[model samples]
Target: MTKDLLGRHRAVLPDWLALYYDEPLEITHGEGRHVWDADGNRYLDFFGGILTTMTAHALPEVTKAVSEQAGRIIHSSTLYLNRPMVELAERIAQLSGIPDARVFFTTSGTEANDTALLLATTYRRSNTILAMRNSYHGRSFSAVGITGNRGWSPTSLSPLQTLYVHGGVRTRGPYASLSDDEFIAACVEDLTDLLGHTRPPAALIAEPVQGVGGFTAPPDGLYAAFREVLHERGILWIADEVQTGWGRTGDHFWGWQAHGRSGPPDLLTFAKGIGNGMSIGGVVARAEIMNCLDANSISTFGGTQITMAAGLANLTYLLEHDLQGNARRVGGLLIERLRAVAAQVPAVREVRGRGLMIGIEVVRPGTDEADPQAASAVLEAAREGGLLIGKGGGHNTSALRIAPPLSLTVAEAEEGAAILERALRSIS
Candidate 1:
């Protein structure tokens, strides 16, 4: 069934648009943590549309909200007064942690980051920027220029001058052998020294956890230490929390909180999970930074009534049910179970993540080299076992990304982990 569709897909879609499995499964519908393929095969979902399905599939509250809003009205440009937009913005602003916070809605993370870059460069008066190696911001012309992942970056051309930094990946960088404290110190020194040689950068934009870079992250306090250095130089800090926000990491509300001893980042961009499958993304910054632009800016469908209705309902359900605590409790058990399973498999090099987000790095047996082929095999094996998952890594896409919806139960976690165990052992 999917083969016929696959032929049509290839005939029109761009080749760069990747798909999973030997033959991609067509997900017709889903409810809770399970989804069905075109052949009516049900499978436990772990990837959650690359972690975008923050709540659950076919969630009743979000469905009702969208239906109700759609029945009344949907599209209203930014020129009009939008109650849902204003309400969601107020809620996000209060939760942003930035003093005197302001919110600007965008349709995707790329646009949010682009708006942030615009704000930073205009306010700081420098086109230079600092980005982490193996990090991915987005696909826009401006966003791709700052991306350090070779596979994701298609062109060398960029409007801003971006310099890559170390410390986002903890296990493979030059500072891999250093202790957490030493690693932080070394990265700080590098940033300080780098600044001495180049023009002052507008900001340092980074993902607290590199989602597309295989869920790798440095020591908890690494960014906090860097924050101090950037603060001293009057440079802004932007946290790309698209994958790490809304308590998906299990331990914190936002990934930046782990390294927030120095306080919150100057500007924060978020997407993916907040709207649960609805297209909603935005940037939160201080009033000074957000209001810096004198020109008019608006996203046609960014803060539309229907999407904001979905966002309001989703966010309410998330908070009212204490989903963050559920993630912390459930994700803790999931990771430990996977770790035990990983120890029994030779192809499993490392299993690391916080909260509900997890990554299993597969490698050539007895070697540290990334094994993309083995990773692909496991992905296929998992699907064959009635399970669905994802793969990502800046290095040849060799890591299996396992991020279930935040609302996952203990039984579901165990079931997914067992399926993954068989998948991992198959490659052994």
Candidate 2:
């Protein structure tokens, strides 16, 4: 049955839509932190479907809200006043920290980011954008244009004149050897030099933690320093929080808070975890920027009744249960455990990230060269050992990404870490 489904998927799906594992397993059902494949094999789900499932699988609150909303109405276009959408927007706007904020919903992170690009360009009257090196925003043409990861970006053609900036990846870069203060200074100086050479950009869009770029991040306050420069030039700072939002990073509610000294970003884009499993994406900005467009526009399916219900319920559950606190505690322990394991595996290059968004970079035993083969082997081994994880990096996809539901428990974290330890050993 799995083979037949795989055959059909390959026939119909785009080749670029990659799947994990050499022999891909079909996820049949899930509960809490575990999911079962079609063959009745249960695995601890650490990736949480690329961190889209912020809460546990089949979370009752989200499930009940989705069911109830579906019974009444599944979708109503943006033409009407949507109560759920309005309520969710109200909650998000209050939490967003932007003064006089306005929210615009979309169906995916790509759309949210594209909307952000549109707003920034229109408001500033500039087509130039500054994007961080090794960042991945989304897959749309507009989002792709700003993406700096060569592995994920397939085209050079772009509607925006994007200038790639320094300092997104701290471990592997020209300034990697510098002290934290020096690194920040160097990156800011580089940004200043880059700006001197080019026209003033509409905005500088960055991921607080570069997600597809292997969960890499600069030292805290790097953005705050850059914000000082961008602010002087009246350039907007747009935080792409698609993967790093909703307390996944543990310490902060929004990833941008890591650079809180600079105050809130001019614009922020978020998706993935906000709706648990439902599609909910949006941009939050000061009213002036969000209202820049003069013409009418609306997403056909954005903020549909069903998705808004899910977002409201999921956000409520996340806050009520303090999942962010849980992520901090459990994820801290999990990282320590993995760091211990990684210490014994020479192929493990680095263990980095905050909270649940941890990454284990794989490299040749004694060299800095990326070891994608070892990463793939470890992934296959982990699957065999009843654990499911993800792999990603800008350097040929050699980093093991471990972002579980924010509600992950200590026991489950320990179990997954043990399985991952054995998998890393197998690869070594």
Candidate number with greatest lDDT: 2
Worst 10 residues of 2 by lDDT: 389-398
Model 1 per-residue lDDT tens digits across residues 32-97: 999999999999999999899999999999999999999999988788999999999999999889
| Number of colliding residue pairs in each model | 2, 0
For candidate 2, the per-residue lDDT at 404 reads 96
Model 1 segments more than 4 A misplaced: 395-397
Error of 1 at 254 (Å): 0.3
Estimate, for each residue in 1-428, the C-alpha lDDT of model 2 and write its tens digit: 99899999999999999999889999989999999999999999999999998998999999999999999999879998899999999999999999999999999999999999999999999999999988998999999988999988999899999999998988787998999999999999999999999989999999999999999999999999999999999999999999999999999999999998989999999999998888999999999999999999987899999999999999999999999999899999999999999999999989999989999999999988999899999999999999999988994547999999999999999999999999999977
For each candidate, the alpha-carbon lDDT, in order, equals 0.93, 0.94
